[model samples]
Target: MITELALRRPDDWHLHLRDGAMLQGVLPETARHFARAIIMPNLVPPVVTGADAAAYRGRILAALPAGMTFEPLMTLYLTEGTDPADLRAAAASGLVKAVKLYPAGATTNSHSGVRDFDKVRGVLDTMAEIGLPLCVHGEVTDPAVDIFDREAVFIDRVLDPIRRATPGLRVVMEHITTSQGADYVRSADRDLAATITTHHLIINRNHLLVGGIRPHYYCLPVAKREEHRLALRAAATSGDPRFFLGTDSAPHVDPLKECACGCAGCFTATNTMSLLAHVFEQENALDQLESFTSLNGPAYYRLPMNEARIRLVKGDAPVSFPDKIQTGAGPVTVFDPGFPVFWQVAQD
Candidate 1:
């Protein structure tokens, strides 16, 4: 068995570092392992304009622990009234890397999201023309559609139509949770790709519902059946450039997660690297780990791969990680893969 592995530092193509106290507490966890991350813009008010993105970026930078090197790749939340000119300026200024599309009521803090796709046509056209990628929460909010079937349905009803209409528009189907999503990205052209989260690779819907409701395992675009989890594992470990790591390590306080109305998100930033090492090893695709975690995301986003390196070592005993991360807000439960992880990132 391979005992030690080293690779170029990875970047998280999708991440949610919530504002204020939450941001300060969680930012370091991601920064410690990832050289950069595409910061999600779905805060309560949302980051809708270049100015909002810039201000958020400032806050992220300010919150970063001293001496830690990390880049927050800003994005704009696409709304019905999104200013195309402001997007152009954001792109030209090189401050914003992409625009995020959240169908209204699709996920947390998404009430301000776009309700009418037709209303955002001009914005989509401008994005295509300017080569700005559109990162999407690939699910529909229709009450008729079963929650488990939303992603597959969204592809057929929404994403396909949008792609067909707007040629050359780069799109990332974020946190894709089904074979439909994986196969679609594989069959699509270079302009399309998908982000497979760390937790999705290990957990299925059963992990969330079986025995009891595992709120920590619950996340938006919720984990699907076992077959879907297998598909994600294959895509991530197949050396397919269309798939990459995007640890959507969203953190919610324990009180919120354990309540009657729990929030949808999994806090995995603290142990993602360790989990990825175990998953890749089990797939016997350990050789392809770097491409999925480090190389592919940068290639897709048109950013350079990180120069720094990280080393993972397989130990004799199960690797130990914190069960929860304590913040001023409260205790945030860390995602437990429900399997022992024997690999850990080597300390400097």
Candidate 2:
């Protein structure tokens, strides 16, 4: 077996590094693996403007361990009344990389998201004009819709019209779950891409319910049936430059996750690269691993690939699923998959 696969270093196209102590606690894991990560903007109030994004970036910088050269590519949270002027200013600053669209009630702390698609038409047009890509959460929030069907439904109701309404607009369907999502992104004319998460590529909806109500397996745009899981695996391992890595490594505390109203996220930031390598190996596509993990993402973003490198060595490596990770507020148990993972990350 190949001990290592070397290519351009990887960038996490989508990531959620939650703020404060949790940020500090988990930042190292992602930094250790990726050269740059497109940081999600879904904080309590959200990073709605250039200034907010800049300030949030500062906090991320401060929390980073000294001499670690990881970069956090910032993004703005698109709101109903979001100022297009601020979006332009943010893009002009060159710090803000993209704008995240979270339809109202779509996911965590997203109650403040856009209520109606029509409301953001002006904003979408402005984004296209300014050359800023709009990254969408891509799941509808309508309570009437079945949870599993939201993604396909959103593509028809929201994504399709949004693309038609604003030609030349760049859109990234973040953490796409269904084959419909893969098809939509693949069919778009240009500047349209989709990010497939490591968890989604490996596990199906059955994994969520098979053993039990696996809270750790639960994530927004939640895992679908095995057939969809198979499709995601094919796309990620197909060596297509359009499909790349975006470990939507969202983290929540044990209480929050285990509560009656558990938060929708999974804390996979720590073991993501290792988990990714495991999945790709299973697909027998180790040669194409670099494209999925590293090359494709930067190509889609029109950014330079990373010069730094990371190595994943295979063995009976161990990662403990701590009941709670230490945060400023007491302890927060991470959602572990409750089994021993086989891949181990090696020092650079």
Candidate 3:
């Protein structure tokens, strides 16, 4: 059995490091293990224009502790009012790596998202022409569509049609939660992929709804049935480049989470790598862990893979992780994988 494994440092293709104090508190959790991450732009006002992205990038760099090295790959939030020329300039300057599409009211801080897809045609067309990928929150906000079935419905009604309408447009279906999603990604021959979150691979709806409400396990594109969880595990550990890791490690303070109307997210930034090592080990696919966590994301985004390496060492005893990450915003809970994990990132 492999007890020590080293690979290229991973990158998070999707992450949420919210503004100010919250950003200061959680940035290090990811920086410790990851060399870079595609930072989510769903801030209160949202990171919309080239200038907005640049300013947000500056704040991220400013927040980085002096000794630690981490890069925040910025992205523009796509809106019905998005300016095509402004997006073009952002992409050309390399200040933005991708554009995010949130169907208005889809999830947290998405009120400024796109309600009319046609209104953003020029932006989409420019993105396709320039080869800037679109990172999507793959769920519809229709009141009629059941929450669990939204992803599947979005694929057939929204994503497929958008891809067809704009050929050469690359899309990353962020945090997919269904078998239909996995199968759809496999069926595509080009310019399409999906990101499987660490929590999604471990928990299903039963893990959320059964026994009682476990708020920390709750996330948008909320965990599905056991079969779907199994499907995600297979796709992630299958060594398929089209599927890769994007923790979607969104953080919401305790008060916001424990209230009558709770926010949707799981703060896994602090324990993602450890959890991933445990999951891959269970599948007997330790050989493929690096590919899922490190290689595939950069390949999809056309960025060079990191030269730095991280070693995962499995010890005789269970590794302990912090229960909550204290932030100026409040205490953010870390995701619990339910069982003990022996593997952890080696400091050496």
Candidate 4:
């Protein structure tokens, strides 16, 4: 049996590092393993402009611990009032890596997202011309749609239509949860791709509702049925460059997660590498881990791969990770994969 594995250092294509205290506490968890990350633009006020992304990048750099090194690939949050000229300039500056699109009311801090697709046509056109990719939250906020059906419906209604209208515009269907999503991306041309999250690959809807309500297991575009989970596992391990790692490792305080009106997110940054090793091992696709976690993301974004490498070791005993991360805000629960994880990243 193989006891150790080493691969090129990975990049997180989608990650959420909220501002202030929360950011400080969780930044180290991801930075410890990932060489760089496409930092989400969904902060309270949101990173909506070139200036905003540049400033946010500075803050992320400042928050880095003394000895640790990590790069923040910034993004702009799209809104109805987004300016095409400004977006072009941001792309030209080469500081912003992509632009994020959140359908209005789709998830946390998304009230300012776009409601009318037509409103952003000019911006999308500009992005295509500049070779900038758009990372999208693939769900519609329409109340009548069943929560479980939102992702599939969005593909049929919102995503497909936009792609059809905007030629050459690259899109990433973020945190895709259904087989429909997987099939759509598989059928699309090279300009499209999808990101699979760690939790979505491990937990299904049943895990969230089996005996009682498990709030920490809950997340926006919540985990789908067992077959959908199986599909995601297949896609991630298929050695396909279009499918790569994007933990979407969002953090919410314990109270915010366990309360009546709990927020939607999962804190997986602390143990993502270990979890991915476990999953890939289970799939018998350990050889493909590097492409999924490290190589594919940079290739998709047209950036150079990291020169650094990370090593994972599997031991006879199950590895132990922190149950919760404590921040000034409160304790944020780490995602419980509900299975013993024996693989761990060897420390430097």
Q: Model-by-model lDDT, in order?
A: 0.94, 0.84, 0.94, 0.94
**Considering only N, C-alpha and C atoms within 3 Å, which residue pairs clash in candidate 4?**
none
What does candidate 1 score on TM?
Answer: 0.99
lDDT (10s digit) by residue, model 4, range 204-285 = 9999999999999999889999999999999999999999999999999998899899999999999999999999999999
Worst 10 residues of 3 by lDDT: 252-261
Provide the clash count, candidate 4.
0
lDDT of 1 by residue, 214-320 (tens): 88888999989999999999999999899999999999999999989999999999999999999999999999999999999999999889999999999999988
Clashes of each: 0, 4, 0, 0
Query: Candidate 4, TM-score vs. the true structure?
Result: 0.99
Residue-by-residue lDDT tens digits, candidate 2, 1-348: 776666566788899888988899878778877789999999988999899999999999999999787899999999988998888888988988999999988899888899877888888998889778889999888899999999999999988888888998988889999999888877876878889987887778888888578777778989999889988998899997888889888878767777677777777767777777777888898888889988988887878877877777776556554455676644555545545666666666
List per-candidate RMSD values in Å: 0.7, 1.8, 0.6, 0.7
Which stretches of model 1 miss by more than 4 angstroms? none
Model 1 clash pairs are none
Regions more than 4 Å wrong, model 3:
none
TM-scores of the candidates in the order shown: 0.99, 0.94, 0.99, 0.99
